[model samples]
Target: MQENQIDHLFQQGFSLHQQGRLEEAQVIYESILKLQASHFNALQLLGVIFLEKKQFIHSINLITKALQIQDNQAPCYYNLGSAQQGLQQYEEAIARYDKAVAINQEFAKAHHDRGVALQELQRLEEAITSYENAIAIQGSYPEASWNLSLCQLQVGNFHAGWRGYEWRWKNSEISKTAGLRNLKQKLWLGAESLQGKTILLHAEQGFGDTIQFCRFTRLVSQLGAKVILEVQPSLVSLLQNLEGVSKVIARGDPIPECDYQCPLMSLPLALNTDLNNIPGVPKKFITCC
Candidate 1:
């Protein structure tokens, strides 16, 4: 109940928070709030813990209370923005991120997250600007670069988009889900000729993505390369008769020996595909469901 006692509890909570002990920190922070209802630091940090725990509504309420007690705190605004983002409230999140950056121009994560919110709203240009701002503030921000690439691709800026798309290897979610393949063969990314060589084109994402990009196998074949396509098991039978593919095998099956390899999604970049020149869906592959 004493001021020093509250401070000691806060310090303990903050230490636990920094160590990623969310439940323990939450208990300490809750105790601090009970003694001093308007305890700004306790409210703000607890709000962050709730955000990390995916308790978005609770995070929003606590962060809002913290901001009322101390309106000038930039981190509180940023946390509020993240909580809003977790709730898919893009407009509100953008407002909070705007406030955070207005208070501290060097807030790179705020700028990047603001870009994400804007991108969700389909505001591609604004999202690109926000991502660029984040990158300017922190030159090594790969997440921003990767999101910027998606925006660029959406707007048909293929030259810049494909170049920026390489940053996906550094984006955490994409890396975790569809990681870079450790291959003995060289990665073909539009630089080398596939002529007189066999190239393994494997699916890296969803079945839909594999189906959509499989059209590029014909283009690869046109370059005089033998194309061996590896796709999801469900699509192996469906895609077996696809044009220009020498072999179509299910993923997890033994892939044939090839001199070059590329993920299906990366084929657009590897083949220098553009908006006007995108290969059409071949008639043979289309059957009405």
Candidate 2:
């Protein structure tokens, strides 16, 4: 096919790619590659489609070939890094991200994903730095900020971590999975006095998180509030008699009337908890379940 014809086909494929019609885009990109095997754009884009499709090896192969055709493309390097990351090749992904940032120092996404790759390998400090770099470039980058908070918490920087944990609400995926409550009551993040108030402490994550953080209900009761604990259906019976809990109910049960509410996970931040002052059931309060 003529160069102009190939260019037209590439434009169509790229348009489809931008529209998220991956299968159609892949077909056009493949057709372009068949006509002109050395087509850099086609190779790179098809690789990206493969990456999106979760065909990591095929993505790696095609993107590698595109890099061979033109090694200086920053986006290609970033996409290659993404493919590597998807395959759990953390070290390789980091290397690719490094190359991308070397080509474009202001590549906030590259820096953020490099942090993710490092974090996957349990390199917390390095991941923190990379996430910070991403935030520095793109001040409004929520994912990087959120991940940085998690790393900080893992490293015992509870205050900073919990402060950043508030960013989780800004993430759509987390908000959906956590089942954000649409209550009329105010969200109590320990900023307001809970004195004489009725508060609902609801589970936001998994059963494990619910169990671990439910201890905060005692602290809430200590604040002169009536604590109503909401947990998974299975744990409702187990935690019904927990100290400081005036009521325990399954998640799907009707929410009782309350003046304020908080997620169990956010209780630490709400109560100013730290490593030195983490709240838990006292030995005297422990009972045989």
Candidate 3:
């Protein structure tokens, strides 16, 4: 009978999870947990479910309870760190990730996650090293590489950061990796003379990135080229006067043929931009999402 009840609880939880109702699934997991405190699966599931729901404290509590039952569980520590990250408890998250890495030095994810927490706390250099360690342990995790590049760029390592930042284009979220109607596909690594070339630079990722990279439109134009920038529609009017930009093309227009293409974020590295060389922009690029 107890086994049947546990099975039923699991089924309910799985059904709710499949339907994307994490809160409801958590309640069912909690009910099963009350009857069987030592249920490891329920414990871990509830912890992760709560984490996904952004109930940071509750997720920490559930994971910590799991840790008490099984002190050697590396995943619990990792999950605990993730919960702490959501709560913006950087120090505690670092401690939890430290324990997880100590238990399993080869745990690349833990190192990367700790780096994210450190980066959030403004420990940029330390975060870079942590990301490097993660790369050493397991090379080329797209998320880690993307984040490492951000930390690098934040600290003015434009050369290295921009090179590494290219990995972001491969992320599944980037929809235009496949060829568009008429634009040529290229990495934009300081190549393809911008002189007289009609370069189409397509934007990728968040609003901040578009704004941040928009400064390059002027740079590209300075090279004696026509710039057709494909950016977010909302940013169209805002980017009208960015330096050197010949045209702002938001969606729906037939993509124009260009001699070259560049990911919006790739220009800084291609140009070897630094603190002194970093292009200044107006209020449009300065604003955040």
**Per-residue lDDT tens digits of candidate 3, residues 1-289?**
4798799888989899879898788888888888898887788879898898888898898888888888887888999999998988899999999999999999999999999999988999999988999989997687788889889878867777888877766555443542233444554668667677788887766678788878777877888889888887898899877778878888566778777777777788778776556677444454221
Q: Which candidate gets the maximum lDDT versus the true structure?
A: 2
lDDT-based ranking, best first? Answer: 2, 1, 3
Output the better candidate (1/3) by TM-score.
Answer: 1
lDDT of 2 by residue, 189-226 (tens): 98888899999999987888888888888989999999
Give TM-scores for every candidate, taking all chains together and pairing residue i with residue i: 0.93, 0.94, 0.78
Clashing pairs in 2: none
Model 3 residue 141 lDDT score: 80
lDDT of 3: 0.81
Give the candidate number with the greatest TM-score: 2
Candidate 2: lDDT over CA atoms? 0.91
After superposing candidate 1 on the true structure, give the runs of residues whose Cα lies further than 4 Å from its correct spot: 281-289
